[model samples]
Target: MTRMECRRSLSAPTGTENDTRISTHENESECNEIPQSKSYPVFKNIGTSQCLNASQEVSDTGQCCHPSLMGLANGHCSNVLEFFKDIPQDVRKCLVEFLSSGVTDDLEIHEGNFHHFFHVANHLNLRRLLQCCVEVYEKGDKTRIKEKIGMCECVHYLEQLVATAYRRETSVLWHEKDLDSDRKFQVLFLTKDKHARKQPVVVIDFARNFKIYKQDIEKADKVGVGFCACAFEQDGCPYIFVSGGEEKKKSQIWQYDVILDKWSKAGKMLHGRSRHLMVAVKDKIYLIGGQNVACIEEFDPISGKCVEIGSLPVAAWSSTYAVNNDTIYIFGGKNPAGCISTVQSFNCKTNRIARLGDLPCACSGSRAVVLGDFIFIATSEGHLIKFNPMDGSSELCALQPFIRRHFVMFVRNERIYITGGVRKSNDKGADENHLYKYTPETDTWSDVATLSTSLPVYTYCTVRYSGKCIIVPFEKFR
Candidate 1:
């Protein structure tokens, strides 16, 4: 299914009282009192026998709280609130009791109080209370609530809110599942700019309609030059381990604390490697290949140490890898001669390496990701290869837009995204600001968003976490 986008139909929170007053008429039932088994603590404390009047603003604050409540206009409640004086005393009492402390079980929902409570709650943006009102209305005479809601001044907004509440109440589980699946993972993009004072981090939140934000390292943390980073979670906290550098920074690994926004030296590789592939499997991280090193070493985040488990059967440089269970599939890479089509699999459990099959063509400077039973590889040649390990079958589809090599690719929520790495007209490697999203289901590509800065090739990785909004909004959202 296509991902759901979050859009605001109504104005954003204004931090003030709702100014839309409908001048509703007081129902005749307002004069009648209904005895309740429960007592109103807030009402008693405020020295009031009934809920606050609709036109009554809390003191001189010019704002209202729960309809059944009064005297809460102080800076206590920040959410938008409204009151309808025309609602009956008992219905206002129920609204106040429900909205005040979020108690709905004891609120007597009879025919006399249904229409008033539903309309008031819907108007006040009390979604929970409106949902309760919808449940009660659905159990009784639905036609009456329909007519009552249809008669509201802003019939469109009123009926829309009513239908939303009704749908939410009926398919709550389905809605919850859809939300969880769509927004569960957050994608983070980091740039490799050693000259910058602090590292630039881009956080993408799919929950908020693919919202993008920027952050700094906050502390004196900077990624080393010529670094290859891998995003992994340690102890339930997201982290990015960056390795590879030149001179003094070589072989050193840095652990970035995503939560604290701090960076510290984590560990060092046994061999300083460049053009290598780093992947996280379970709790351990595997650093494979290098310009010359053929050994594959495993690094333990907890111990902060690297140990060489085995060596590649055929050492290949500039190779990419994808892990499935205990096995890691090493894709095409360059050697001393040139790019090689050799494919190899290393089993972490067995500590063994075996040749799988050759690629349709050598794919140096490529990226690979596993989706279901197939592995999708995006080559620098602008070709997408789908490889099936079961039968050793491979199919290549050339990306028309990506006529030149140098783009970066990453997968989130089973969708592939390519950005940056465009060869400029100057015949020089430059950053391409355009971001493209590819969907395997339809085998189609669409430009999604342009980045504030070009994404560096092999210098970015996605970390999943609960993120916050940024001060600088992405151009796409604006």
Candidate 2:
């Protein structure tokens, strides 16, 4: 209902900043300093009188020959108590206060401490501590901790550390014949320290056999036909936005959460559109030409509202378009005069549109995909036209084996994939569904796989998410 100007800020630090914010004491010794042999700390089990050596080499399995300071009689041996003394005095004091108070408000750690803390935990086999950090990082709620730290930094460090530790432990276990295959060893130490703080340890199961199988995926919740969809990720979750289709060219919007495998209503657009082009740049989704409309609208997913940004110089429908950098290139489409080969460019930063050169020929209902600086347009006549928007030069590169119209195309892993397009039948003389793959390096086209049903030929949208191709079919209108 109201127009809002979209702006982005660049206030965050460019490189790694302090995430933990743990106070540094002027009197405390350096964290990197190795303790002298004479000054090495002595660790003792809570109930045992004998002290354990700090430099005692822990087995690859973390089993200690002598009793551990945590009072484990014959379990995994760890020198965490000894290593705990090596941490900066300020850090040690904060940790002690944190443990004693049971309140995070007084204890503040920076994100920069994540790497150091993780390495220390791995060296000491502090499984509970690692799990606590993992939970805090995953939840992304700084308030859950007394002092806020960088959740992303902590989570990234923990993932890398865990993966590396898991690999190393597996390698050692595979080579050791004396270690029983049935023995359940904790790669991530879940044992509690003297403080009694314990958390669940994620065990690496080596006995289970993993297999990969190709199976048909269940259909997503039905949405209206003729709508356009775009894929993007936010807050570590993948989502697909479907908008402006059937239901009388409704402005209704819906979002599919890949993680939850559920669909929910997003806000409606300012104008109902079909056969439109939607491209996500940063946080905003740009809705381009559709249904004979020259007006362009910008939809903000965060605000759940669309605003009229600008208008196209020429009204067109079913035109092939692609975004390169901050500019959007619109190619051939049908206009009032019929099929038009006009090409135009819209600068997003300046909100201005300028005329580029026309295509080699009119290509209504064509699909355009951008790979690097080159824009490839697949036309209904089964022609693959490569055009450079910078110099306005166009050339016909390769021809498709089967002519197609109203098809979906996208680029993934540097290869172009096309599917669900109508093709002339060889025997029955009726239009059939077909799938194709094109590689830019060899400038060639090849047939990859086919679909079970021909419904995609009628109405469907394709998006690549999490290294997998997801095809969402539109519900047919009765």
TM-scores for all candidates: the values are: 0.57, 0.50
Winning candidate number (lDDT): 1
Model 2 agreement with the true structure over 117-205: per-residue lDDT tens digits: 44343343333344444444445544443232233233344555344442222111122342332222111111122232322111111
lDDT of model 2 at position 375: 94
State the lDDT of candidate 1 residue by residue for 1-478, as single tens digits: 0000011011122232242221111332222221222121110111211211221211213111222221112112111223344445555555544433445677787666666665555434444565666567668776665665554443344344455444443221123233222222333334445566655555554333333445444432334544577888764456788887543355888887553334688888999987788888888999998888899999999899999998988898778888877789999998899999888998888888888778888888787878888888888777788888776678875473554455566665567777666553556532366666777888888765555555445456666542111111121111
In model 1, the clashing pairs are 54-85, 68-96, 406-421
- Candidate 2 TM-score, true structure as reference: 0.50
Q: Which stretches of candidate 1 lie over 4 Å from their true place?
A: 1-194, 218-222, 404-406, 412-415, 424-431, 437-454, 466-478
Q: What overall lDDT goes with each candidate model?
A: 0.57, 0.50
Using TM-score as the measure, the top candidate is 1
